[model samples]
Structures are given as C-alpha cells and as structure tokens.
Target: MRVAALDDDVDQLELTKYTLQAVGHDCHVFQDGDSLLRELRRESYDLLVLDWSLPDMSGPEIVQWIRDNLTERIPILFLTNRREERDIVEGLSCGADDFMIKPMRVGELVARVQALLRRVYAEPLPTEQVWGRYKFMPIGRRLEIDGKAVSLTQKEFDIALFLFRNKGRLLSRRHLLESLWGSSNPPGTELMSRSLDTHISRIRSVLNLRPENGYRLSAVYGQGYRLESIGNEDYEADAQLAQSQA
Candidate 1:
C-alpha cells in the first residue's frame, strides 16, 4: 500500500514516514500542503496522514480540496496537536475518516490506518476470479485467457496479478517494486529497474494486453504504470497508442 504524510515539522514527517514504511507501506512525506497537493494531482495514494495546521493551509482545507477535486474516496487520518472536541468534529465533518492527536502513538496510528483500509477495501478475491476475458487462479498461480492457459514465471505472475487487481489505478514504480521486493529493498536501482521493465514487458506480451482485448497496460513516463480497461469507443480513440511503448 502507498501512504502520503503531510507535516511541516521535519521530525514528525520523518517519524511518520519511518513508522509507515516499517509496516510494509510505501510512504511519501511532504513538509507543506502545497507540495502534497501537487503530488495528489499526479499520483494516487491508498491513504493520507495530515497534520491539522501548516504554514500555508489547514488540514481541513486540504481535505476539502481532496474531496472536491478527486473522484476516489482515499482514506485520510488527521495527526495533529489539536485535541479539542470541536477540532475533532471539524476534521471528521470536513471528510477525514479518522483523527489522532500528536504526539502520535505508533501502534495506534498503524491500527487505525489498517482498520480504515480494511473497512473501505474489504472485498475478498475469489479462488478463481474471472475478469473480462482473463481468469486468475491465484493459489496455483495460473492464468487463463478465453479458457486457454497462458504460461508465466512466478515473478511474471506476481506482477501480472498485481496489475490486474489494481486496474485503473496509477501505481508508482516504488509501490510496484515494494510489492515484489519488500520495503527494505531499494527501488529504481539500475538492476531493479531493468528487472521490473523486463517483467512488465513479458506480462504485457503474454497477457495480450491491448485495446482489442479490452485492456491496455500503459507505462506513464517518469511516473509508473496503469492497466486500463477500454471499451470499443475508447479502442478507436486510443488506436495510435497501441503501437506505443509499455
């Protein structure tokens, strides 16, 4: 999972990042509201931890901006010094899913975040899940297209399953790498980058991911990858992109 933390205090930001990352989440930290907002525009995050006060904007203001501008209901937690009843009410009313007072307790933060995520995204994958023309048997690590089996390496299967499960979400390279290699491993190293690209290429070809197949796995330059499901209308609209790089 990917989490974004916004706090002006350097120590708090580091603590938030470290604590979240320690628990297998890819954490992105920002010291100001503007920077965080800018990132929210380009990338997608599973959750957000925000301080109530900042030099430029209030946490509620940022929450309002997210609720108004973004289509996804990304869970948000308030981590701040404010502990008044009115403050908590305001935070929740403005669209925050959870509220926590700082000096933040690491255990409580993690528990609250995990609980929020579990509640929001609770749908379980079936043993044999069918998605459009593709069927995935996760336990056996097998994939079938139109009732025909397709062979894939273990790594390739992992990557392909991840992309299929998260279709339409813009997954950052760091998030994808962390999913495969764990948070302890460094992302974007030359070797890791090559390996990631290779696996993606293999999966793209093996899956026959194209508009004709009702799916397109696209590589967003300088960001990451997104597997999009397209209809016939979109197929024609994106014909030129079919020949482009993945």
Candidate 2:
C-alpha cells in the first residue's frame, strides 16, 4: 500500500518511514501540514499515517480535507501522542479510520493498516467488483457506472483503472503509455494518446459530464493530464481562492 506520513517532527518521520519501509510498504514523509497539502494535491495514497499535531494544521483537519477532496475512499490512520479522551473523540469525529499511539510499533501498524484495507476494500463475492461509484462483474469484466451498465472498450477499462489507481499524479501521454503498455508493444499500438483521449471521452460520456460540461480532466499544458474529480465540485470554490484574486 502507498502510505504518506506527515509530522513536523523530523525524527518521528524518519522512524515511522523506516518502519513502514522495512515492512515493504511505500511511504512518503512530510515535514509539515502545508507541504503535505501541496504533495497531497499531486499524489494520492492508499493510507495516510498522520501526526496529530503540526505547526500549520492538525491531523484531524487534514483528514477532513481528504474526505472532502478525494473521490475515492482512503483510509486515514491517526498517529498521535495525545491519549486524552477528548483527543481520541476529536480524531474519530474528524474521519480517522483508526488511531495509533506515537511511540511506534511497526508490525502492529502494518497489520492494522492491512486489516483496515481488507475490511474497507475487499470484494464480497467472486463475481463482484466495486470501485468508487462504479461496479464491475468480475467474471465478465462488465462495468456499471452509477448503477447503469455501460459498455467500455478494453483500452478504456484499462485507462479507468490507471486513473483510479494513480489518482493524484499527472500522467503525460508518454508516461501513461509506458505505464500501461511497455516498449514491447508496438509504437502505434491501440493505447496511443489519441486513443487515450478517445477513452477519456467515452468515460465522460458515460458519466454525462463532457469536457465542456465544467467537469474536468485537467490539462497540465505541456506536461500531462490529471483528473480533477467533481465529488463536491470544489474545482475553484474556496473562499481563500476568491480572496486571493481580490
């Protein structure tokens, strides 16, 4: 699982990062909440291991942002030194999936995170596939969007999973092609950039939100495309964003 560890404490970040790495989990550490937020905009992780206190923002506040911004449900694990009753209540109320006390236990942490992932994401039956707001029939690879079944081209389905799995990173046509299909595939394969554009068009069509509909697939001008999901439609709606322009 890809995990992000945020803490103002350098030693703690290193310790936790080492532990997570030792267990074969990918981890990214942040020195402060603001930096983490910047990175958060560019990358999404399966689990967030956040320190309860930071100089700029508290862990609970970050958790709330994850719930609001990410279209996919991500597990948040609160790592805090505070053991007070109010602390625990506040963290849980703020959308933390689990709590881990800070002196650190690597094995227990990995086990708990694995268990939470299983409970939250595991499919119930052999023929079922559930991802975000879509469903798939495992046996037939049939996809349903918002309860209505939609026909997806094979490349479209692959592109969908690639987008879902790498929710945060901007993927260029080159990076995308490399990741989806390696050098072995012909240069003019079915998964070319125009093909990617076509797949994205088809996906948007199924959702009833076209590129012209204010729903977006962010074009990074010379770099690549990054999905900007419209779960609560916050693409440019922050009061702070407005005040900055003023």
Candidate 3:
C-alpha cells in the first residue's frame, strides 16, 4: 500500500519513512500540508500519517480538505505531540480515522496503521466478483456480460476490474497509470492519453456500460474517470433529459 507521511520535523519524517518502508510499504514523506495536499490531488494513497502541527496548516484543516475533495475515504492516522483529550476528539471529529500522541513507538505506530487499513478496506477479496449482469472470473481470466462472453486483453480485464472495485470514486490519471502501467507520471503525450482512452472506450462498449444501461463510465474533466452504478429509473430520467436537450 502507498502511504503519505507528513511532519514538519525532517528527522521524524525520515524515521517514519524508514519504519514504514521496512514493513514493505511505499511511503512518501512531506514537510508541509500544502505539498501533501498537492500530491494527494495528483495521486491516490491507501493511508496517511499526519502530524497535528505543521508549518503551513493544521492537521484538522488538512483532514477537512481531504474529506471534502477526495472521492475515496482514505484512512488517516494522526501522529502528533498533542496529548490532550480535546485534541484527540477534534482530530477524530475532523475526519481522522485514528490518532496517536507523539513521541510514538515505531512498532505501535505500524500496528495502528495496519489496524486502520484493515478496518477501512477489509472486504474479503474473492476469486470471482459479480455485479448486476457482469461476472468477472479473475482466476479463469474470463468475463461474462449479460450471459455473453466478451473477449478482452489481459490489460483490459485488469483495468476493468480496478475500475469496478473502485466504482464511484474519481481516480486520477496518475493513479490509473501507476496501477496499470506501473508508472506514477501522468500521461504527457497524445499517444499516452489516446492509449488509455482507447482501452476505456473498448471496455465501455464491450460491457454495454452507459447511463441507459444502469452503468456510467465517465471522464471527470481535468481529473480522470469515475465508474458509477445508477438505478434504472434514474438512467431513464437522464436519457429523457438528454433527449430533451438535444
């Protein structure tokens, strides 16, 4: 899992990074809330380790920004020097999932992070996942849409499953590229964007994913993409509205 650790103290930031990395997790350290927020907007993280006192902004303010802007409810753990009960309450109320008063024991911090991850993303991953009229058999690398088998490349299948697993969340382009292409860099060239767009189009067409079909795969302007499930009645109403506009 990718994690972001924020602390104004350089030494503490380094220590946190080392401890998290030692446990086989990719951890990035940030020195200020602004930088962390910038990266958060560009990439998706599984968890965040934040300090209450920052040079730029308070931890609660950062948590509020995350809750307001991010589509996914990423778990956050506060590692701070503030030990007052009020501080803990405020942090939790501001949307942090967990809190730890500093100076923290590295081992306990790691355990707390693990607990939060488990609590937030604990759904058992099965060999197969079924949605509405679609069945995805990961073990067999097969997909059936409304009783009809549709051929898809391995990459296409992986992308489809990723989108489905994170349906209703706006995934940044960099996040998709990293998950699919193994790179964190955003697509820069026309060819890169076209490649991703082509795969998305193919997946939508093969799955018959449209608002009228109770599923919508849409691009989020400057962001990336979001796949959502809608009720049949809502889809029909949207179709009618679109027809009226046309």
Candidate 4:
C-alpha cells in the first residue's frame, strides 16, 4: 500500500516512513495537514498516517475534509500523542479508522497500517460467501444460497462483495468511510460518518444477520472494524504457538 505520513515532528515522520518501507509498503511524508491535503488533491494513496495536532487542521478534521471534498476514500491513521478517551473517540467519530498514540513503537505502527490496508484493499476473495442463507457467486456477483435468488442494493452488493473477499482484515472506520463514501468536498465529520454508518446499517439490515455477531464484520477495540481473519505477525506467532501447545 502507498501510505502517507503528516506530522510536524520530522524525526517521527521519517521513522514511520522507514519502518513501513522496511515492511514492504511505499510511504510519503508531510510536515503538516495542509500540505498533505493539497497532495491528496493531486494523487491517490491507499493509506494516510497523520498527526492529531497540526498547525493547520487536526488530523481528524483533515479526514473529515477528505470525506466531503475529495473523490476518493483514503484510509487514515492518526499517529498522535493524544490518548484521552474522548479525543480518540472524536477521531473515530470524525472518520479516522485507527488511532495511534504518539511515541508508539515502530513495529506496532507498521503492523497496524498493514492491518488496515489488508482490510480495506487486500481482502481475499471468498470461494463462496453466503448472506442470509444466500450464497454469492464471486465472479458473477450473483446471489443464490437457498434455491431462491435474493436481490441486493448496489451498495449492499458492494459491501457483501468486499466482506466476502477479505474475511479477516481489520479495517479502520476512517478507512471504511473513504471506501464506502468516497471524498466529496472534503466532507465534514457529520456528513461522512452518518453516510458511512447508514451504508453499514443498510448492508447489515439487508443481510439480516444478528448484530451481535454479524457475518464477517467484527469490531477490534482501539483500532477499527475488521473482517474475522485480519491481523498481524503477533497474530501469526500466536497461531504458531497455539499449534505448538496443541
């Protein structure tokens, strides 16, 4: 994934860039939110890592703007020092998918960025995904689970398709906002978030799955929503360890 970092702290920004690159992702850097926003207008990136505090706009505010004004959905990660409960919630409420408290370990940040990218962009296609007992054809995008065919809204279908493809990646809320809502007029917090939630609710209702453990969509506390199987190396290590224990 092509990831961008926006921070006033040059040292941290470079460290983030280097760490992500070492882990096989392309990265870019900006010292402030405004410059990053300008760059957003000119290019496309799979992900953005921003600081919560900036000279121009807070990362949360910038994310809202991207949702409203831009034509694309770019996953946003806030690499800020703000760890107040309300502050983190505000970031997610404003459309940020993942929030990283500043002075974060490099490995942890890289893993998280990868997790979001996998969730939002690199989800694997399902051999077959059934929604409400309706099995879907991946290639043809047709639904037929119970012998009877079921219809879906266009966005609903897209949601199903995306979920089916990437069953295990955790996607951040800000990232989902971009993926589902796209950037238009650099959206305000209210518009983008409400629109995203609406889309999610619409999808959930159509599938008729219990909200408690709805289909593939699961919440990852302190990060974002993830498909059932998405995670990092530690997750892999745990799996290996489990096998050893077994």
Best by lDDT: 1
Looking at candidate 2, the ten consecutive residues that score lowest on lDDT are 207-216
lDDT digits (tens) for residues 1-246 of candidate 2: 567889888998898888887766667789888887776665556678889888988888888998898665778888889888899899989899988886877788878878877776543467665655667664665778778888876767767656654555566555566555643234886547677677777876665443233345555665557765554446346434767999
Instruction: Put down candidate 3 lDDT per residue, 14-75, tens digits, no spaces.
Output: 99998988887768789999999998876777899999999889999999999999878999
Q: What are the models' TM-scores?
A: 0.81, 0.56, 0.86, 0.51
lDDT of 1 by residue, 158-231 (tens): 89988887788878777787777765358556688789999999899989998888998999888789999989
Question: Over all chains combined, what TM-score does candidate 1 have?
Answer: 0.81
Clashing residue pair totals per candidate (backbone < 3 A): 0, 0, 0, 22
Model 4 has an lDDT value of 0.70
Query: Scored by CA lDDT, what does every candidate get?
Result: 0.88, 0.71, 0.86, 0.70
Itemize residue pairs with steric clashes in candidate 2.
none
Write down the RMSD of all candidates, one decimal each: 3.8, 8.7, 2.7, 14.9
- TM-score winner between 2 and 3, please give it: 3
lDDT of 4 by residue, 1-246 (tens): 557889898888889888987876667789988888887765556788989878877777888898898645678888889999999999898988899897879888978888898778755556666545557766555666466666776666666666555455555555454555553224685676666567666665666543333344555554455445324554566568878999
Best by TM-score: 3
Residue 113 displacement in candidate 3 (angstroms): 2.5
Where does model 1 exceed 4 Å of error? Answer: 41-43, 68-73, 122-126, 184-188, 236-246
